[model samples]
Target: MQRNTYGQSPPLHHPVPQHVSTVPQLRSPPPPPGSAQSQQQGYAPTGQQGNPYQQQGGTSGNVFGAYGQFMNDPTAQVAAQFGQTAFKQGQEYVEQNIGRYVNVAALKHYFNVSNSYVINKLFLVLFPWRHKGWSRKQAVGANGQEGWYLSPRDDINSPDMYIPVMGLVTYVLLSTLIAGLKGAFNPELLGVTATTGLSVVIVEIIALKLGCYLLSISSQSQLFDLIAYSGYKFVGIIVTITVAEILNGGKGTGGWIGWAVFAYTFSANALFLLRSLKYVLLPETNGQPSGPMQTDSRAKRNQRTQFLFFYSYIVQLFFMWVLTRA
Candidate 1:
């Protein structure tokens, strides 16, 4: 009321003290070396901070780094794709054609052939003359067994691939052993021998297929049967070579005994193939020739059969000769 002239007596003149708030200062201890917080702050590990020569812990990092460049490389991708494609194609081909060529179940059945049957067949294969009641054309026995048959019995549907495969492997192994005994073993030569023998078999298969084609015979299964039949020559080959090797008696080559055994086996193999393959080479007709036309056709078929039968003999002889050299 004394200074009313200043404005309304200074509005009661209540001097309120100003309040000032202060926060306590904090200094967190510097993060310990190699701690999570320090690492999070982009600090290097304790020993590596100033040492450029510090070696890494594991070498796998370097390995991964080297190969990783190719992981995305276009050329590597192309090569990988190509290899996969080729492998798939080859697998498909084998899956489709292997059974058509080599039937393992049939092979196993034929491989179960008895020793007596083999011996009898061997004799019949060699001589082929009618001996007692056993002839090449005698039907399979009542016991469902092929008895004294040269080739595979017509009724018995087993075309064995096992015997021939075993025979080939045994022949190669024996030949290698013989070469080793003579101090002339060469692994290279062993490979050559295998290739030679395999080529001969392949050629025989091809030739038989060609013959069937030329004859206008549409029997792929029969052609494969013929191949299996032809492979039996390996059995004769093994026998002939073994006999020759034994009779040679360190002579380094066969003598008269070897040649004689070879001759017998060769003839046997030819005869076996002749009787075995006749049905395939010349399928018999149920009807007899009733006219000149029929006779002429029959005669032509007979001539072809004879020619093919002789061809089989010649091929057997050549292959046997090659095998004997081992």
Candidate 2:
């Protein structure tokens, strides 16, 4: 049974398609240039589109270029030159002015000794009788000074402070050792002994100077010369003590045997000084004088000889005894 109306048929229905098209769709066009939408879409502004790594490298290159320019600047070069000039001037000033306080040349000359010189000097101090030459060797300086004493290495008779200073230290150490063996050692005992020894030397020098002044003995020797001669007694003192200690079975106190040894040493040291110091106290003369002035010079020379004998015998004996007690 079909019932069809004149104006209306049954409404026809169509199902929607379930499958999508396989063809690629076109994307929306990029937003207009210079618009906020372009920026929001991660597009760089005009004239700024480049690699990020290239921009970073350019920044580093600019920094290095600036540093190079600064280093090559005229002001930096001037500063470097100024620093060098100041250092050079300071060194020159020190060299020029330092001589006022210290005689650097003389110090160097005094210390310019060799191993052979030291060994020979020690042997000479211990056994001075064998050496015949007592006068220091002389040299002619560049300035035509004829009496310049040779260095210790060249002249065995040349005086030096090195041996004296070393002997002083050894004396102090030996005194300490002796004190320890006697069970009387203290830390302060070393200082006391050193002070005593130095005091004795100073007193002896003062006495000798006074004697020279009173006797009108005009010697060309420097103060260090006298000190060097005076310090030689330490060698004899050290030998005497060592022998005494050995004979007495390590005892510091000496007996009759020690006295005998000391006497021999004392006589030997006196003779050594008598021979060595004659050149200093009495200068050699080529001709003898004949007048009142000659007589006066002769008298003064005799007085100086007596003073030397007194110093060599009496002064040395007293000081040597004092050191042995220390």
What is the C-alpha local distance difference test score of each model? 0.64, 0.76
Q: What's the TM-score of every candidate structure? A: 0.54, 0.64
Which ranges of candidate 1 are over 4 A from the true structure? 1-158, 287-296
Q: What is the per-residue lDDT of model 1 for residues 119-216, given as tens digits with 9 covering 90 to 100? A: 55545545664433322343366986544323343323245455567667877887888888889899887787788778888888887778766665
Query: Would you list the clashing residue pairs of candidate 1?
Result: 126-268
Q: Name every residue pair that clashes in candidate 2.
A: none
Residue-level lDDT for 298 in candidate 1: 67
Q: Can you give the lDDT of residue 228 in candidate 2?
A: 78
